[model samples]
Target: MDERHDPARARWAVAGLFFIVGIVISTWFTRIPQFKTGLSLSDAELTVALLAPTVGALTGMQFAGRLTARYGSAPIARVTIVLAPAALLIPAASGDLVTAFVGLLVFGVVDGIADVAANAQGVAVERQLRRPVLSGMHAAWGIGAIIGALSGGAAIATGLTVLQHFAVMAAVTVVLALVAGSQLLPAGVDRSQTDRESPKRTSWRTGWTRRVLALGLLGGAAMLCEGAISNWSAVFLHDELAATAAVASLGYSVFTVVETATRLVGDGVRRRVGPVPVVRVSVALAIAGLALVLLGSPSDIVWLAIVGFGLLGAGLAVLNPIVFSAVGHGSVQDTGSADTAGAAIAHYTTMSYGGVLAGPAIVGWLSGAMGLTAALACLLVPLVGIGLFARVTAAAEPAVAD
Candidate 1:
């Protein structure tokens, strides 16, 4: 155990919590029909109601920066794990829509908080280890998602009901997450910032004008790819391929499995290629993935789409942490305070999270209007956009060495 490191085991614990949260959130999508029926909501009304929870979520994400900066990542992360998993209890217990909405809102808050704080913790842990480790942390998150999705069938089969089931699972998972995350660094402490006039004096404006914009945009595009799959993959499978709900989800399931596996090995891949090449390769893979999905037929080519999405997941997995790493390095290069890094991270996350929140609905609406094929083709624009951005901003600009 590296003495300066925040116990690798502890970080893994945090990783597990984040993974469970991912599972619960994704599972909720499957449960939306039940939610709609329970609430007696029409399609339009359901959409409207769903929007409210995201509103709360976005608001929480926006403020997550200030909260973490002041309060620290570990405590906030702990609270979010508890809060988010706890939110499961409400929907599990309630038979009505109003209560479900409130539960979702709570879910949103925990989601935002856990996401920001965990990333923050990952940064700290990475610096202490003095090597690339974030990919593995994210891989753990993906694995958690797989476990959650797999369990959904069992939960339904057991006949305990969604509410009762989610509540019990929530309580158990949150406690485990809290226990696992206890020894990590506090949120705002920067292992990379040794030359200190104190980090708190730093401001966001100074950071954004630097290369942080490119980093933020890149992170955003990668996030958009993920959002696209979660929201549109099932639709594409169901409508375009005429598959069952279970089969339709196979699209995302394959993507998650491949993505998780790649991420598990991504650290070595990045080490061999470097950030610029890794990003370039990943973006190219993403473009190919999206293209394959667009062109492939359900009868003979659906597996091709699955393969494409899997490649896309692996390609995209390295990005989120890489962006955060770049921001931390930028601050060091500029000889700026670590607080600036926090602000930069906050900005990048804002763009990335916003993309995810918006990508599905936007894709869905476009699919409704122009057809699923056309909507899938629409995704190509962003892929091209991201590719061009990566090429132009290709150089990592050499970390401003200490």
Candidate 2:
């Protein structure tokens, strides 16, 4: 039952699940403007409705760790992955703002649970592989996003209804989830159980260690940047840069393609340069990219925004993998139980979800008050924070115990 005996299968399964997650999320994001118009909502009204998902995600994060700890990640992943896409149909078919809010709330809860389960599986597979495969697995997600954005754009151009588009996406995701779930390691190989049997169980209190919090903060900032780009890039292009709807969709496609490419090589980069330096450089690139986005909006150079988004995507490519890997490596103290490790990951995930949940609403509010350009500029605060904290915290990563 040891997954290490067949690490290759486990790795592929985990990667595929990550891909499905990406597709589900990106499909919803790329169609946000359509939803707004269909519901006849203002930017601020849309922002308010969007908060429903954040509320659901926060609620789901509270319990996903414990559920994964008790049930094993594969089973939890199978159920949540299936439920996430099915839930998407609700919002896609909604005729009113209230209905959309309810649907998004359901989708968010299931999606959040699936997110935690997938990462747990990824960490487990990485431990079995005995190398830096986490980043490569995350790259699968970027690939999925690229495909989703491009396809969604095409579907819209061809006059596909939102309901019809979501139906197709849900079917595809369900099929992929079933196949990938079957290939994951059996329940006996659960990483959480293994940690629970360690000689020294890491106390609940140590789960809040300063190093863990710092890594969580860094990860949260990175997720915020990603959420901003995913949810707003199309809108930014159409509204600020005066691009057409079809052309605006290409903005997200460009960003995701670059992100996928960067993540494809992220594992090698981390091995050669170490995580801290990688994180520092990545944040710096993001800061520079956002600056270009701000400057390009008014200058009427759409290429600048596209190029800047690509750089931003590249910069964020490795962030989640590095942060998750640090948690796995640092959770090696003899005193730590599998529950302790799960708790640590949950804490980190909660912070990251906070950023995701808040990012779109914050951007919408700011854009309504000022302009989209000024709204995006606020990302510099978190980007700067990532640079300052990346090295110091990553340097403290504990060696994983054999």
Candidate 3:
């Protein structure tokens, strides 16, 4: 990295951006109760309204590729810097269902854009710095989520309204994001930063080649499991396993801690082992973890479920990072595509969130037909498939950047 680019600073900037994105989204999650109460919404109505973000997010991601391809990651990231944080006001600053839905839809769109753009920026930082940083960047997001949740708790305790809490956080996020956005690598660095041979592959279509598609599938599968586990773990423990609500809550808590811890150390592990080994190991752990869940399902054992969720977190923690790194590095080398990596990352991210959005609904449908046990057990199918296609992405991970 050139002294002018200040690769180390740029890396932190991206990390900060990641945190900003995570915290803003988490802020929304933490306030669902307020939204429900303030709007006088029924449970079913809230569920339907919550779907707006997912739909809007998908729409936003579909266009982010083209936007980044034309304007570069830095510019798009800066756009998110303003839009995502500021858009927080939309969802809760409403009086009617139609208005709230529109607000959330717009929020989801901007959030989706921010998600892709921030990741693309992270990729640029990795390439410019010539090492692995994506995991750590993701770790920042996790950390931010923790803070967001805690802050939300505080706000609730202090009797702040939803709008008041969101407004304050939104302001803070915009200020912080501006600082981070300023330090992002200048436009075009994602394409220009390279230490390896390049120019062999041309066109953004390279983003959708078989290898990239395979990586996308793997990422989607992992996130699908995450969505299912996150949304259902407590329910499973409380209802299926006959645990107390307090104990049931520990399921997701364990998963979150394990996932965050794994992400914290994942970069060093990836630096030592290659991406292939990292992914392969992830596949094994995820499968073993889910198997443990199945083993405990026959009986009402809460500890078994808790342990299973922890392992599942460990297994799923690093796969998405690996996928993102592979796609970003691949695009850097294949400079022929204007934003080949951007386009590809957008697709991968879209599929990933789609998995999360769809996972719960899919499980619900399956549960109706075959019971929740069989439904969750069905996740193993994708985990095994992830193992089969682990090598598709050409991720020859480089050593840690100094």
Candidate 4:
């Protein structure tokens, strides 16, 4: 096969960008302690500082679609990946809290834009290949996170300064960007044929129709489940379930391991059964898992909660992929809008971030009021919502009764 223009090559290129973003994010957060010490930020200040990326990311997402439609997924993805690691260096070398905030904010902006572009490029490759590759691409991100964490630890253990560590990572990312840029899709590949002549002003109505936002709600709900598990699993295990400290740590590791492994093979499952069945089953599994987590409290079996957490990871492994891919494929049509698929992808992604923000806070607030298990149990409602909305990701929409 001539590899230069092969869709597989393009797929790998996009996947590399996803991997790069993952590594950039994981590296930054893993080294956050250094920022705290170096910048001498108070606890409250640190919490506020941590929010910079989320705010920046949301702001960037608003522009991602227009940027992609104007240029293309490849150019934007390539530019962002190259900038992402360098953005990390901002915080790494920041001399004050304000500077660190600015650095992280920039990093988040790059991250938000790169996310939509890379995924749009991946969807384009999947269209060319006529199969599901998004799952594996996402799985690549999970793998990159593991590698980033390990490498970040290695950098710390070897006594490298934060700036030096980030600089090396940035250098490596720039070098890899050359290879990714060479093979990623061309500038107009993911854009619509009519997009070039369409009026440049994109009103929110373009892709923010009912269905896309509905899909966003579904995606957001799933992400809330994820955020809960990732942040609260350990706390739930140790504090609520009376598990050992070592056991508590295992909860998230198990969730991550299972989630990544499931994603590696999830594309095949989606291909075999179709997305609707996959999503329905996924939500059921997540609900079942959360149920087990709740049951562990009454039965006092911590292992059930552990297994439940793994199931939650496995269940959610491909949901966001399915939601994003569905939007990219235009499976759900809406009112007439000239928005490119990239724009639509960017639109729903904002809601996804909203879920990420709400999850931990909702859980914590409920934990304080009703208790931890009950707070987690509340996730069931959204899990059910996911299953109910599974058809949004399917090829055919149910006909409306006039």
**Residue-wise C-alpha lDDT for candidate 4, range 1-402, written one tens digit per residue:** 356757889888878887887788888878889878888889999998899999889988988888877777888887888998999888888888889899989988999998988887877777667778798899889988988999999999999988999999999978988798889867666654565677455545456656677889999999988998889999999998888899999889989999999999988998898889999999988888888888898556999899999999999999988888877766224423223778888988888888988999999999999999899999998998899878878842121211
* Tens-digit lDDT track of model 2 for 1-402: 555436688788889988998888889888888888888899998998788877888777777766666667778888998898899889888888889899999887887788777877776666656566778889998778778888799879988888888899999989998988888866544445644465243333435667678788888888988898989999998999998898788788788888889989988888787889998898888887887777777767888888889889888888888888777555544335434455567778898877876788888999899888898899898889888878744532434423
Q: Poorest 10 consecutive residues of model 3 by lDDT?
A: 192-201
Model 1's TM-score against the true structure: 0.85
Which candidate model has the greater TM-score, 3 or 4? 4
Give lDDT per model, in order.
0.68, 0.78, 0.80, 0.83
Q: Write the residue-wise lDDT of candidate 3 on 52-139 in tens digits.
A: 9888899988877666666678888888767876776876788888998998888889878888888887877776566788998898
Candidate 1 lDDT, tens digit per residue, 248-354?
78888788788888888876776676777777787788888887787675465777777777777777777776776766556545544444445555666777887
Q: List the residue pairs that clash in candidate 3.
A: none
Q: Would you list the clashing residue pairs of candidate 2?
A: 195-338, 196-338, 200-334, 200-335, 200-336, 201-335, 201-336, 202-335, 202-336
Better of 1 and 4 by lDDT: 4
Candidate 3, 387: how far from true, in Å? 1.0
lDDT pick, better of 1 and 3 = 3
lDDT of 3 at 210: 61
Q: Rank the candidates by lDDT, best first.
A: 4, 3, 2, 1
Q: Is candidate 1 or candidate 2 better by TM-score?
A: 1
Kindly report which residue stretches of model 1 are placed more than 4 angstroms away from their true locations once superposed: 1-7, 191-210, 241-247, 297-300, 365-370, 391-402
| Model 3 quality (TM-score) | 0.92
